[model samples]
Target chain A: MVEIRMRVNGVSESLDVPPWVSLLDVLREHLGLTGTKRGCDQGACGACTVLVDGERINACLALAVQYTGRDITTIEGVAGGGDPHPLQTAFIRDDGFQCGYCTSGQICSAIGMLAEHGAGSASAVTEHVAATGIALSGAEIRERMSGNLCRCGAYNGIVRAIQDVAESPR
Target chain B: MRPFAYVSAPDVATAVRAIGTEPGAKFIGGGTNLVDLMREGVERPGTVIDITALPLTGVEELPGGGVRIGALVRNAHLAAHRLIRNRYPLLSQAILTGASAQLRNMATAGGNLLQRTRCPYFYDGAAACNKREPGSGCDAMDGFNRNHGVLGVSDSCIATHPSDMCVALAALDAIVEVESVRGVRRVPMAEFHRLPGDTPHLETTLAADELVTAVELPALPVAATSRYRKVRDRASYAFALVSVAAALEVDDGTVTAVRLALGGVAAKPWRAYEAERILLGAPATEESFRRAAAAELAPATGRPQNAFKIELARRTLVETLRQLLTEGSAA
Candidate 1:
């Protein structure tokens, strides 16, 4: 057994999980953080998306022991005081979730996407990297968030929700 | 997932020693591919050496005008590096067209090259995969080969290397620096990944104890005009049907220098040496391009659903070459 201490959802949590247990499994089964859904146990689906050290990654593809000493931010931690984050509110306003199964992952992924954009990270669609802050285009947003899939076919609204947040005042 | 021992190596020396101490030990870099395989029972390692914390992340300029990328450098950082974007444009484009944004952030350079194929039969424990089980028959050959290999594929295995960065590195003449309990050695990109012949289980030339430390790219002049193109089922987040990474330099309507490599069509990164030989010093024309592409793909023996890859690869190479030539002429 490996004891790992990580800051999950703004709280310090410690658990002695088997070395092979994935972070997604620990979050859902052991700690009861089921908001991070698991669509496919493999890395194909983004339902297990979470932020480790302020970067989005598929928790299902990560071992919990490998994430020690990292600041973890899951979907449940995005909202404090039972209130929604601005991105979460925007996603709801835009009706981004049709079946609502991939919402948490989608929201967590979009927040990380915005952070990447803010830091001037370029996507496949972005032609210029040295150029200053990129203008968020629909194609850019779609390409950047392509890892997160919503089986409900709600990509259009999700794109719009992310675009709305990207355009909002910082 | 099965039970395993986990240890975090504080530095390179400890990491090297840990691998030698543990049996069936696998180094964990990004955990993007290894962890998924572990969950599916594909990899049953008795020990997992977490190598991510070691101070092995950087993209530094080599003394000889080239670049040395650390093994732990994230895919996103490697793709977005200033020199890589400006000089090695194909490398940047290749990494960007790979997995999604989140996966790129987590995927490391060494892990990306070492990732196993996404063959369904290999992942599904019920099916017979020569790669997963040595002596077992290959189900992909007789079954769904829509994503199987077309070049350098032996009867024993037909899985393709599922990496975009490696394809670009192959074209750029990159070399991988690896360390093991014994010592350190440098492996050229062309010889790093092995073609699955009778021993389908053996993927790379690196020994089990060897750990990839860095990838060194040789300096080149054609890198200024490099490009990477991929044709996939979807516009994004999908593996390539056929991808091309090319760096060309044409002078006075004649091919002065050309470096081309292919992905999603071979057992390894298909470096188009034959095609380069045909195009170098030849005039830039549509007919020459066709002949060159045909020469490069002559060894392509595709399965039923994947025969279209032959034509797609041909067109992709022709298109990329034409674009490069046109951009050169305009400049």
Candidate 2:
């Protein structure tokens, strides 16, 4: 077992884990932060999405030992001080999900997607690769959020929830 | 996943030595592909050397107008790099088209090039795959082959290389830089990946002990105007059924310079050398484009489920060139 230290949801935690244990298992089993669901266990499904240093990645693909000393954010960390994140509220208002199995991942992925877009990152559907300050069009949101899958067929609502958060003024 | 000893390398030399000295040891970068294969029991490394801590994680400009990308540079960062977006937009476009936003965030440049084929047979332990196990008969040959290769295939195996970025790199005339205890060597992009002849197990020119340090993209002005077109089952988050990476230069309605490479059709990124030769000094027209595509694909062979790839490749190549031609004229 290797001793690993990391900051998850603003708490510094240390644990001894085997080399092969995935971050998903460590978060779910070791720390009991089960909000990060494991739908596919592979990278195909976005149900295990989490933020490492503010960038979204699949937790199932990351080895727990590899993420030493990194700041990781999960669904539990999204809302601060007993208030729901605006995106979370929007998800509920727009009915972004039916079963809610993919809700945590979708919310985390959207936060990262918005951060990437704010940094002027281009998506596959972007007309001009060099253009900066890309407008958050519905097509752009759909393309950027394609990584997260909502199997309950709530794509229309999910897109609408994200759009509401993106269009709302800070 | 099997239990493996893990060590974090401090630098390049340490990483190389760890892999060289330990038997059945593998280097882990972004862990996107390697970890998945490990979970599926496809890869069984006894020692996993974590090299993410090595100081090789940025894109730098070479002395000559080229760009040298570090091995650990993540795909998402590489695509958004200012130099890549402005100079090699097609490369940026290609990287964006592959996988998804989350996977790109976790995948590295070196890991992307070294990723194995997504062949179902190779992943299925019950199925026979020469790549997964030597002397094992290939089930993809007679099995569901709609996603298999049509070019550079052998009877022993028929798997396609599954990287959109490599196709663009091939067209841009990139170079792969690798290092080991034996010292460093530079391999041209064309020679980096190997054809699946009798030894389908040997995928790349990289030896087991060697570590990919970086990939260099040589200065090519044509790459600025290049474009990558991937035709897949869906518009987003799907591997290519047929893809084309093309850059064209026309002088007074005559083709002066051209770079063409294909993906989802061969064991390696199929650089269209025959088509490039045919297009040089020829009239920049759809007729010439179609003829060149046909000449390059004449030697291609396909199985029943994948026979459509030949025609799909042909049409994709022609259409891509035509688009480049139109863009050139408009400019």
Clash count, predicted structure 2: 0
Tens digit of lDDT per residue, candidate 2, span B189-263? Answer: 999999989999999999999999999999887777778889998889988888998888889999999999999
Question: Whole-model Cα lDDT per candidate?
Answer: 0.88, 0.93
User: What are the runs in model 2 whose C-alpha is more than 4 Å off?
Assistant: B328-331
Worst 10 residues of 2 chain B by lDDT: B322-331
Docking class of 1: medium
The numbered model that scores best in DockQ is 2
Least accurate 10 contiguous residues by lDDT in model 1 chain A? A125-134
Error of 1 at B270 (Å): 0.9
DockQ numbers for every candidate?
0.57, 0.65
